[model samples]
Target: MSESNSAGMFSGRKSEGLVLVVDDEPDVRKVVRMTLEKSGYTVLEAEDGEKAIAEMKKDENSLLLSLIITDIRMPNMNGIDVINYYRKEWPSVPLIVLTGFPDMDMATSMLQHGIADYLVKPVEAEKLRSSVSKTLEKREVHGF
Candidate 1:
């Protein structure tokens, strides 16, 4: 990415930035999208890691992404792969891991990778909102 394009995402001009939600379940995606949209954030959906990467590559708005929330148990392309891709290509965009099967090792590893949050499945709406808010705030202050 170009320096100007990278700067755009962290420009801090917008009140809320676009977020990418990656999960195989449509219902989960819908809930996340609705929750985020209601909180004044624009959101995009992807079924898996591969699709998420494709969307980022193809969509113009993806360049404005401020956050990514991904589920770990997705088929074909899991959250680990998604995290790896993000850390490699867009490490400035903060990530959150939402998983049903939470493992200590995995959470530790993901946290070490600098992910913003690791939330368990069936997360409360308020909790999700709070996490997103806090993560975004941290990004603004820390730029990471």
Candidate 2:
């Protein structure tokens, strides 16, 4: 609502932070970007894991990234590959999984591995916003 908009724009804390959304589907990326942007987050998009990795390699992007939202299935390197890279190289950065296909076992494992959240796709705007906010806040509290 208007309150959320103002908090994003006029709050003393500034923006929530930069969020990278990795998904193969353009529509998915667009929706996710719009949602996060509205919540006062700067969003970057990557069509696949390779591009996400490329983005992460940059000192500018990687240093400012508060969270990463990615789909489990993607062409070229999958989300698993991205998550592995993140765990090995940047475990302090929190991650969220948004996918149409859900595997409970995989989800459980990912949660155990410290992923922030695993959300089924077509995520409600409010839910996505809340999750992103909470994840970013959690990262902030952890000093990451």
Candidate 3:
């Protein structure tokens, strides 16, 4: 994404909220970051839940996060733990889960745990953008 395009995405907005994207795959993270950055959000990436948690903690003073997008499976720590931690510590921030497994039980569990949306792996660009837009819109409307 061009700097001009990214800047234009939030030029008239009051705030261009930061988004955290977590996944073990570098390719996935790159695509996600590009997608979100093109849409005007500042994106942070972490390779695993531990790194994600550290990123969150490091930004505690800033607290500019508007959303989190994470993959379900990872080494060291999984997305479930990350989601649970954020749900408790930063309940106001919305979360979206991206997983390859797509098990019914896991989906149900994620929803029950306060995820704003769930997406399957190999996500299309349009789908990712749509999901993100809708989720962020909901957060804005509800004053989350």
lDDT by residue for model 1 over 61-124, one digit each (tens)?
5667789898877555455776787778777889999889668888988898778999988899
**TM-score against native, each model:** 0.81, 0.82, 0.79
**Which regions of candidate 3 are displaced past 4 Å?**
1-15, 59-62, 76-79
lDDT, candidate 1, residue 30? 87
Rank ordering of all candidates by TM-score, starting from the highest:
2, 1, 3
Order of the predicted models by lDDT, top scorer first? 1, 2, 3
Q: Per-residue lDDT tens digits of candidate 2, residues 1-144?
A: 222211123345476687888888988988987887787787777887778778766656777778889888854555567678667766788889998966798889888877999999878999999998888878778786
Measured by TM-score, the strongest candidate is 2
Better of 1 and 3 by lDDT: 1
RMSD of 1: 6.2
Clashes in model 3: which pairs?
Answer: none
lDDT of each: 0.78, 0.77, 0.76
Give the per-residue lDDT of model 3 (tens digit) for 1-91: 4332121234454545677888889888889988877776777778876777677676242267778898877655565776876677677
- lDDT (C-alpha) at residue 90 in model 1: 78
